[model samples]
Target chain A: MPLFFDLLGVFFFAVSGSLLAARRGFDIVGSFLLAGMTGFGGGIVRDLILGVVPTAFVNPFYFIPPAIATLLVYFVAPGVQRLVRPLLIFDAAGLALFCTSGTIKALEAGMNPFSATLLGVTSAVGGGLIRDVIANKTPSIFDPHDIYAVPAMMGSGLIAMLWMLGIRGWTWELGVTAVVFALRILSLKLDWRVPKAVGPWHHDTQLR
Target chain B: MPLFFDLLGVFFFAVSGSLLAARRGFDIVGSFLLAGMTGFGGGIVRDLILGVVPTAFVNPFYFIPPAIATLLVYFVAPGVQRLVRPLLIFDAAGLALFCTSGTIKALEAGMNPFSATLLGVTSAVGGGLIRDVIANKTPSIFDPHDIYAVPAMMGSGLIAMLWMLGIRGWTWELGVTAVVFALRILSLKLDWRVPKAVGPWHHDTQLR
Candidate 1:
């Protein structure tokens, strides 16, 4: 079950990356590379911070899904790009799952709850952050209007709380996932956005 | 002596990152954060790939130089920016040192010579890559015009070859460093630029 969800997360992220690359009209190799980066980037960062080699390089299973997704997207670009509804569902599930799993791994790495929870959000969002940066744009998450990291943080925080309370079980994990998944769904449906900072300080910041 | 060069590398990288952030008009905190990222990003990636925790978080010495650099940049923006001539020399030295050290570390981690050499280039270039991406620009090294990563790879590959030949010592490391440093200096002096990939695929890339 865990592996199933992990693969699902990889698949969704890879597809998103493929879609972005296609929108930018990148070549086949670029699309494949972007898909692989998106699928594995967050996990790689999470593992790195936890002081482990990236699982994607070590395990073929972690790499194959992205390769497959990239091939599929390359072959059927328009069709895959248009599958927005299913993609949204899968992406929301992925966001939640990665946050919980990333937090758990950080906790295992001996990180404190606060740091673990933050790392959980980093795990969930870091892939796309990297993807956008490489694609030559400001990261969407840093825009302050994106709710992506917020949902991940909320869920990861809850997981941390549960672990601190010694309530360790699959039940809490599932509940946390559901909460983030629901929050993501709602945020999209409601068109929610975080308020942007204003003023000259935000405009042209001076060191002194 | 290695530690001394290592700190010098971090300080140079941190100053460069802060300069970039200041150019982008980012806030004080953003400057500090970017400085930290540039100083530690490559080592973190190198350590993670080597299956070790980030030395920056483990050792304060690895981090303090960046903090100091940020503060220094913050206070003396125009003065520091004007010091680019000396900074370039320090940066070149850092690049060579990092590539040699990074490759040696990868070799120590049991990676093959080819992989170790590649990781060496990554360690030398990765920090600047992250800094540029966060500053919302394409990486200068990726521009092909920049001889940055090329020289690093050359130095690192030499380090790996020296290791293979069982010629391990400071003399060889110094020789490798001289090779990269001289290459960088010559590239700048000769106005060398790698020929751009000139297909339709490369057209829309901004700042090309």
Candidate 2:
């Protein structure tokens, strides 16, 4: 059941990636590659950091989601072009699951609580970061207008704190996921934003 | 001796990364962070894929070069503003060393030759890719105006082929490094470039 949810998360992430590629006017190869990378890049990086083989590399089934996502996006893009809200909802769900799972895995691997939380946030946001980077755009996490990573950080930090306090179980994990999902969706709907750089600092003070 | 060379490569890569950060008008924190990421990002990613702890994470000494690079760029930007040529030279040197070392490390870890070659190229270009992405720019490897990854590919492929043919030694490794370095330098000097999408293809035919 967990693996099924994980695959669903992968599918959702891949769909977002392919949609971005289509918007960027990339070809089919680009759509497929981006979908795959966006689906698996976070887990691959997380696994690598944990000194384990990436599940995507080991399981053939992991490849199916991205392929399906690419095809779906390519074929139905014209009709599904304005499904931004649905996409954001799916992305939020993926983020919730990934942050929880990543934190749990890192904690199980005996990473320090702080590091585990960091890794958790990475797992949640890393795929979108990779996708935006590949598409040559500012990552939403870095964009002050978006509160994307904050919810993941909050959820991961909460998980780490709970683990430290000896509270660990599926119920706790599920609760954390729900909290993160709600936070993300609410932030998006309410147009919540984080503040950018403050004080008297010129943007072009360094290079020019 | 190899460790020393590796550190030198890291330093060169960090300098290039810091230079880019400065050019992008990032503040001190951005400079340091970008420098650190570019310095060790490749080796860290390679180590992760090879299922080993990243040297950057384990070794405190590995952090020195990026710190120095950030300090150097931050302090000297006014006087050394037009060091693009020197920066490219340093970047090329780093590229040469990283590609060869990455391939050798993969082979030593018992990865197959093709995978080894891919890892090699990734090591050579990963840092720059990360840096560019963070700065919200197109990765140079994907830019048709630059032939950046070609030399790394050539070097990594040659190294893989040689290893498969049972030809392995420091001398061969050094020879391959020289070949890749020269290729990169010459390509830059001659303004050589890879061709963009050639066939009849519209750039903005998909999304809008």
Candidate 3:
């Protein structure tokens, strides 16, 4: 069922979060927090925008994967580095599932198409942003060499397009997810990058 | 009157965010984004956890002050460093207002006191966290020299306690706010810091 796929996506993202935490040298609290944020942060952001209690708090099922991931990272992180290939693949899959579903949810909540697409991208990438920020690094999306956000935007845009075309179904969702997954995986393997912006100003940055 | 105070808080927070952005060398977009985040991010986080559309989007009033603050930062940032003394005052006032109101909102939404207090603290500090994260710095609250989160926590805890005592009024709220504001300002002036944990592990570095 869809719930199963959702949980699977959460599981992979949690592993990625925890693994990243281990690599960064954060203690156990940091690992657990990162896993939760990676698995649920995007959805929580989306839900908050839409005026809903985050599902992560409402359903205990969402906690399981992240908890397991933290334990895995603590126990076997050294060996996990060799599994980068699998990790990247799972990350892509999670991106696909999350981006598509995130767009759908936003649209269903009556958001405008453009904002919905942006929110979808947020739902896909926001968790990683939180993780990177907490680790005191520049967000990967803002990195000139990073291709992470582009494919997520592309997939989210496609979902918005599908909705505009008056077509909505699991079949369409599955097809879009596959395309996003492929694109992400391909981009990773080929070391593709978004054309960098040469902003005319220094990076020193902001306000309320 | 409360709305006026709310806008005043937003304005001050926006200025703080913009000042920080300028110090970090972020461009105009970063200034605007940080302003918005610092002014509205905490409340949005609180609303999301409480299941409400953020008031910022519901009413145009919330957006005005941050926009103005961004403009001010763009126009007169160089001279504003001299304003740091006053800036801390406004920042403390904003923190007091936000912490008290955030706690009240959570209690009204029926969350348990512990969670409500945590949420209130979050609403008080979340914006600065966003700003620091984007600027690629460790959040000040996590720093041993920081007194920010602790004071917010204390204020939030007091609000929760007042609810438990069946004493909820504007008078009580103002008293709590005054106490928190004084504590923050005093800590800043005195260079007070939270004692840090001597953790058993080294800080290695990555999760992915």
Candidate 4:
């Protein structure tokens, strides 16, 4: 069941990646590669840091799912764009699943709570960061208005705390995921933003 | 002296990355991030794989060089583009240096010859791969016409073999670097490319 959610999350993220590539007018190969990276890059970085071989590289299923999702996005993008909001909701669901899973995996690998939570945030946000960087945009995480990384950090920290307190159950994971998803959605709806001060005179023209 | 060369290489690569970002009209923050990644991403990956903390993140000097380089490019891209070929030569020199340095670092960290060679190749070419991905271009190494990765592999392998044979000197390192640099230059001059296979089916206007 956990693996099922994992695959679902990977598929959705792949779709999101493909959509972004398409929006940027990337070719088919670019679309597939971008989607593949979005689905696997974060996990690869986390695994490498932990000295574990990346699961996506070894598992044929993991590879195939991203490719399939990329193809689906390529063919269905015209129709899919009409329902962008719903697709974003799915993306949020995938983000929640991935953040929770990453926290669990890091803990299982014996990382400390802080590092585990950091890994979870990285897992949730890394792909989008890559995508934005590739597309030459400032990453949404660094944007004041985006609540992306914060939600992941909060949920993962919550999960680590609960796990340390011996609260181990599907219900617990689901609760944490729900809190993250809700926080993210609420932030988006309420236009929540990080505080910022005005730039110095010379830098003011470039501040975004 | 070695630190000087490292800083020079970081500056050149960071400028290249910034120019690429500017050509695509990225904002100042985007330009800085891309430049930083191009300058430091490979070394960070190599260190992490060898179970060492990323030196670029720890050292303020490493961060500052790239930032300065990005500022230079941000104000001088048009002039920089005219020197693309010369800049590439500098980049190749840096690649050779990093390949040797990375292999030695891996060996010092107790990695075997094969792992050391792999790390060296990755350390040399990894930044460029990340740069290409972010710039939305096919990775130059993956292009059959580009001899980028092959040269790195040869340089790394030679260093590993020579070290195993107890041949440790500036002479061996310089020789290997020259060989890699010469091969890259020759490949460019000769328009050398890997052979391509024929199409599975020849089609003309999709005759039905």
Docking class of 1: incorrect
- Model 3 alpha-carbon drift over 4 Å, by segment: A1-41, A48-96, A103-119, A130-138, A142-208, B1-41, B44-93, B109-119, B130-138, B142-147, B150-167, B170-199, B202-208
**Which candidate comes out best when scored by TM-score?**
2
Question: What's the CA RMSD for each of the models?
Answer: 7.5, 7.4, 7.9, 8.5
lDDT, candidate 3, at A60: 52
Candidate 1: where are CA atoms >4 Å away? Answer: A1-40, A48-101, A111-121, A134-136, A141-208, B1-8, B28-37, B44-69, B79-93, B110-115, B133-138, B142-146, B161-167, B170-179, B182-186, B189-208
Where is the poorest 10-residue window by lDDT in model 1 chain A?
A195-204
Q: What docking class should model 4 receive?
A: incorrect
lDDT of 1 by residue, A151-186 (tens): 887899889888999898777788888899899888
Model 1 steric clash pairs: none
- Kindly list the per-residue Cα lDDT of model 2 for residues B1-208, writing each as its tens digit: 6677778889989988877766664545456556767888899888887878776655546768887887777655543347566668878888999999999999999999999999999999988888777877677677665579999999999999999999998889889999999999898778788655654476546634
Q: Tens-digit lDDT track for model 4 on A1-208?
A: 6777677778877777777777778888898888788778777776776677887877788877678877887776666456456445655776788899888888888776766776777677676776677667656554555466667878988998988998878888988988988887787888875422111222334321
Task: After the best TM-score superposition of candidate 1, give how far the Cα of residue B39 lies from its true spot, in angstroms.
Answer: 3.7
TM-score versus the correct structure, for each prediction: 0.59, 0.61, 0.58, 0.56
Index of the highest-DockQ prediction: 2
Rank list by TM-score: 2, 1, 3, 4
lDDT of the candidates, in the order given: 0.74, 0.80, 0.75, 0.72
Q: Which ten residues in a row have the lowest lDDT in candidate 1 chain B?
A: B78-87
Candidate 3: what's its TM-score on chain B?
Answer: 0.85
Best by lDDT: 2
